[model samples]
Target chain A: MFVDFLYELRERGVKVGPQEALTLSQALGKGLHETTLDGFYRVARALCVHREEDLDAFDRAFAHHFRGVPDDALKIAEEVLQWLLDPRSRRELTDEEREILEKLDLEEVRKRLRERLAEQNERHDRGNRWVGTGGTSPHGRGGTHPSGIRVGEGETGGRGAMAISARRRFRDLRSDVTLDTRQIEVALRRLRAYVREGAQDELDLPGTIDATARSAGELEIKLRAPRRSNLRVLLLLDVGGSMDPHSEVCERLFSAAKRATHFKELRTLYFHNCVYGRVYENGSLTRGPRIVDLLRECDRSWKLIVVGDALMAPWELTASNSPWSWTEEDRASGIAWLVALTGHFERSIWLNPEPEAAWYGTAEVIRQVFPMFRLTLDGLTAGIQHLLRGGERSR
Target chain B: MDFARFRGTDAYLTSPELESAVNCALALERPLLVRGEPGTGKTQLAEALARALGLSLIHWPVKSTTKAQDGLYVYDTVQRLYDSRFGDGDVRDIRRYIKLGPLGEAFAARDRRVVLIDEVDKADLEFPNDLLHELDRMRFRVAETGDEVVARERPVVIITSNAEKELPDAFLRRCVFHYIEFPDRELMARIVRVHHPDLGNQLLDQTLGAFYQLRDVQGLRKRPSTSELIDWIAVLRRAGVESVELDDSLPFLGALLKREQDLLAFAEAMHRGRRPRA
Candidate 1:
């Protein structure tokens, strides 16, 4: 039965292996589950399911396997309940009797219970000779044996277990869904490229040893700068209008980038729909720095990440006389500015929150200007990998 | 050796599932890897277990720069070099400069202990994987002295992570994992009562109602956690604020919501009339 449950867990895509199965069996052998269905559920969950994302699948598997207890098991459970509630067997034990009961180890009691269970099979065979009511057995409930291990008291009803399993509390934590801040952070960690730079502070042990040997046994210490990530990230976020639907994901990416310690520097600038003359430093779309100056200040070393849906009128990218143009430099088409920015940054990628199937119109044009990838986990990871591998400077 | 089961202490309340996970780890003699949202008392579980079992607690707070080797022992080569140059103590004895880290201390101790590796995810991604062997065998070999430090009695190891980085599958397989769920209303009431015994029932009810309602507000950057709720209650009681209503105005909002964006989002959510309080 346990093996079948393990198979069920694997069928549901929970990566359970033979090692976890062994751990579960060992736990059961130690009587950790207290020989109850609810205890089994709890113990099984802790042992088999390691990730919170896998918990939803585990719950589905659990509900499928233990949909309901078999009739015979329920009958035995009822009989066990009756034995536990027998009034005549509730007498208080003397100190010596309690001491003797305490002397009976838990493992010994569990072994005896197993023996009784194997020896007695029929319902009518429930007697003092087995682990049944009003007996001096050290395993059954409400018996004369003080300190007896309670078999199945305080059981969560079958329906209650189903309800608990159906809760599926960790469904949101699954990686298949839209990225959370932590997931985004994990993806962004690939951007790190550690390079030794700056002041020499860390001790160079091998160098010190070599220097000491060269100096004819004179003690000479050596120090070198610690290895630090030299990756610099410049995030160009499209905020306001049409991009409203994707603000949450964009915010998550932005926050993750801002919090990422793997990069040597992270700079965020906001634009609407497409880049024009200016990019706002803040999310409110207030004027901050000119695109020309930004490109000049941050060299090709900065990896550019452009985030937008790219679903706009074609004129927004190519029109020279667009009314949205705020400056004389803005009159030079949006695509021109985008091409210049992408060309300046040797490695750049555009992450569209929209699904790949929906990428058309201006999105396609932007893709031509900068390699576009969907903003899902796989897409983000691929984009990071692309950034790590230096991409062509788009003309 | 007999192992004493840990039923949570008076100050720390644990659900039955968490208690089961702790005991399972104890029975299996494996590390209990605890992951949860911040302020859910992931680190406190180790302390509670230590107190409950009458063992001393050894805390090893992991930082971003912490390496797996730092947890075992430090050779202190620079210090040895300094000593040799200054002629302080005998620099030939490499063992003299070897300082034991928290994990090394836990292993070398005469009695069993509870070792809390707080925020294991703060370190590099390979940090947990690096300690897999030492954690599995409960022993480490000091390279400088070639002496093996083995545990007299295996210490109860409790590792806590904020789920910042995904732990390696090989490391996860060896651990008994448990995620701490945020307290439900009844549990929260009990927890609040533990902190504030003299608080009025009506005030407690209203505060919890408002707190849960605020948590339900959509688009909140960060939902207020258990510790925030406790602090909010303390502030309300200290200020003698009688009622907490989830309306246009929420008293002591700063205590509940830390981020400026979250406060703005809450006000916007209220403005949208999503939460029309009766």
Candidate 2:
């Protein structure tokens, strides 16, 4: 059994050998005899694998060797195939019905869904109440609902559901498509503050040669490290919603910032739509500490870089009692907070993902806060230069 | 094989999954692959496991330009050429120029040893793939000496990555994987207690709350890690400040938050009356 598994791994380009096979056999006889599949997987992986790249191959091979032919019905591909075959059966919900459904509160929809499920007798079709297909039901697939717990079907269209009720592992809506970090790295290079601040341990080859010659070949070597950049950058990246299209570029920027050793200090934060009373560390920002707390604790000397499209509903930037806020009490507008941030940081700029021409027509609050620059290499260079010059620009 | 024996160690904490993974890796003579964010103790786990298992650790820190072969052996061809041309020294024996690297040393050790490949992600993409065969067989061919150096006793290998680059899937398959998640407030408190036993609960609690608050800052690229926390506490202890006041710890913020931006933002927050509770 182990030999067949080893054969499978080798076929998958795992590079397993006799010694590894021998060890595996011994392991199976001892520690792995009564272990669970996960334990077996761990042991087998350890014995046969050496590189992380081969993990997927090994997994495929192991599944093939142990589990036999994979059942297509267990996969989403099967469901997709079925959906394609029965394409004519799917019914589209009317616009008026969708509008009415959209007005239903999420809690009320959930309650109605539960009641419908309890009363349901059989598989339903084009029904309004029971959990089934092609209906105004908020429970099943091939149907439309303003807000729903879409059970047992893949998403066909955006209109199929307004809100997801059940916990789900949604496809990473942020494309995560990548751009070459090298270009971003080059752009970020301009943002350095070239000032020597650290220990001089770097060897000066030319100086060492000259000094050695000057000292009558006494072997005296001179050391000089490149002046460390004292530039401290605080980047607040906008994520989610409209920013989804720009994820790849944003990621490239994030990666470049993280990789750049020139900056003495670089920090990053995430926000969605607009900066409210808080900012978050994670992209989803479902559960993270408030950004305002950290802002209050900031050093004030750090250069602030706010990266976002600056195209959001005016309410997000100016309304004290916006929908985004969890509290009933009126809070200060996002513009107020941003204004405070600009005042706090001596040198700061907003790097707009959108073009320079677009900013004039975008939200007025965005224009009111800081000098907005396009998110290009040239724009970055210009922004950094503005920061280096160190004065408040006309807002 | 008995992980239970090392449970009481104050230097490091091991989760059940990690304990199992380590044991499995050891039993199967496979390298363990650890992935985590920076400062999550991926490298420390290797050191701790080595100490716990009573094995001599052989460390091979990787750089971006590092090759897989550099971990096994490095042939001093230039030195040999220099010796042969200029000196009367014997350069015919190639073994003299063949310096065994960390991996080679681990393999050559007669007793069981632990090999730590730290920051494997820093290496070029090919590095992990190139080591696939050598690591699987626990042997490598020294081209200079025309000898195959095999492990006398299979050395336990622990490979850590910061996930800087997506590692080759083949390399990932050969190892038991573990991700050390960022320590929560309670877990961090426990970790702090382990490091500083004499610290008062009130002081530790206050410090942890502030640390979490600081870490929660949205824009911080690098938050204060455990080691930094330890350093901060040590600095505080050295300064002999007993009351654990936020104002007193201002000067030592450099130890906790290295980024100038983080330091500035922290100062702004402190002045803005949103400071952590005393």
Candidate 3:
């Protein structure tokens, strides 16, 4: 089996001639039988590993070529195949492969191999140049150039340089490619392992019949992705003034929230430190489109993360929009909108960039409203984590 | 150091055993299953391969909801059911609207591609077995029909598991395996330099020293990942600061640790890094 394995190497372009195979066979005869798999592997590997790379490829090829050989012998073949496989096996390469590997580089090596094969043919050919074509040599070609200058093709002597150049070029031109990493990240994100369907919920037939007595057997309970109670945000962002020191942190938290809020729905409304009857998205500002849009869109499906240090005048939390909005609807009792916005979210948390101690001085009204909205002081990371963990209604 | 001049780039890439695993994936050749620690770049290996190899990366993010078809191709459950019941074969070409799931896209890819089956451990036991048939044969059956489409060649298959859970033995048999480890400090620093070259050496030293100190402490829920270090620098840049100050640096904590408790614990440790005498 081992001898046959060596023969396979030659066929695969390993240059393992019969003599070397015999020597390996004799080495095996002496005392290699009881050797560990590792031991045999080491011995074979030393002789076989060339190129200092692609050992895995060589091992794979070796394994495939020697499929069911005994373990020790298989290891030996693996070593040999690694060392020998590179120069042989493949007859042709794709155009991209050739281009990337630079086809011209192999011109030297291929030329040398061809020259060597031709010389072997010639040295033996001259001695037996007799032919069957009405007394003529096979190289005759109707008596053209006496020595068949076809061998005189290129003007290089050793052709060793040519073959070497070609091989080097081909090796050098190998495309610099690796597997796409994003695909893996994406795969991990959307990974679904099973077809999980919830058992059907029993229907309340009597109630349905009462609502539509004439219709009979009206609405039914169904299986779905499940009503995922999600998140919504009425962000009264302290966009300017005293908020400048913490603006960077706020922006980053916003970024994280946008990305991390994938599981449930997230709708955001922006305010300048205080709530008004109106909320703004882009440039448009109308009272009806306030937190109510978020409320309707969310349908009690979201938790609001209002990001700002609730640190303005008491009146700012009350009737007036301290930062000033011209609309009469907004200016009148902005505090009503604040209370309404809090109700709009299933649960709302105040992510104050300001330290806990600093939040105490905020409008007296805010202090009253603080515990009501489930407000708390958390830095950027904590704040985000709190939202992701699902901001709840009080401890 | 100069990435452009490494004339032997492929040689170096192959020098690492994992790189070979990556190359096999590129040849559309075979599946590679990597088992490693939580952050050992096992999963990231696939993403990197996709980018480096220039193959269209179709990702089938695996989870509990993950199924073989989910991994192979996206199936619109609501729409498919709706059309099947109401339209009665009269709907538009569903095959066109079939929404090729990441795994299915890889198999269907006319060009060479990489399909990442991330966190196979998160999936059910049957998920791996279900995948085995397609993986072994390099082909999958479309749900609508019994037609089996083999890949133009195999996609460089990469399946990463955080090792929090174990995958099935059947899945293991169908793949070429490698276990990636977190790069050592030296490698970590190298990675840092690769990703964020703008940081000054002095600031880099302080940040790295802080990391070393943090890891040396006890009972912390998490340690910073290479990715987090980049985020920290980005924060510093965004803040218009050339150096990372000991104060106001807590926000970068999220990038490093997974849990909120870990961040608080890490921040507490940072105080000790500064006030050694205390």
| Best-fitting candidate, scored by DockQ | 1
Which 10 successive residues of model 3 chain A have the least lDDT summed?
A175-184
lDDT tens digits, residues A175-278, model 2? 11232565466567677666655677866667866876797766555678667777788899999888888888888889888987778888788888777666
Candidate number that wins on lDDT, 1 or 3: 1
- Quote each prediction's TM-score: 0.67, 0.47, 0.41
Candidate 3 Cα errors over 4 Å, as ranges: A1-395, B1-15, B24-28, B37-40, B73-99, B244-254, B258-260, B267-278
What range of 10 consecutive residues in model 1 chain A has the weakest lDDT sum? A156-165
Q: Model 1 - which docking category?
A: acceptable
Q: Alpha carbon lDDT of residue A330, candidate 2?
A: 27
Q: After superposition, how far is residue A354 of candidate 2 from its true place, in Å?
A: 21
Question: lDDT tens string, model 1, B141-188?
Answer: 998799999999899999999987778778998999898998999999
Cα misplacement distance, residue B264 of candidate 2 (Å)? 1.9
Q: What TM-score would chain B receive for each of the candidates shown?
A: 0.96, 0.90, 0.77
Q: How much is the lDDT of residue A40 in candidate 2?
A: 65
> Considering DockQ, which of the candidate structures 1 and 3 is the better prediction for this target?
1
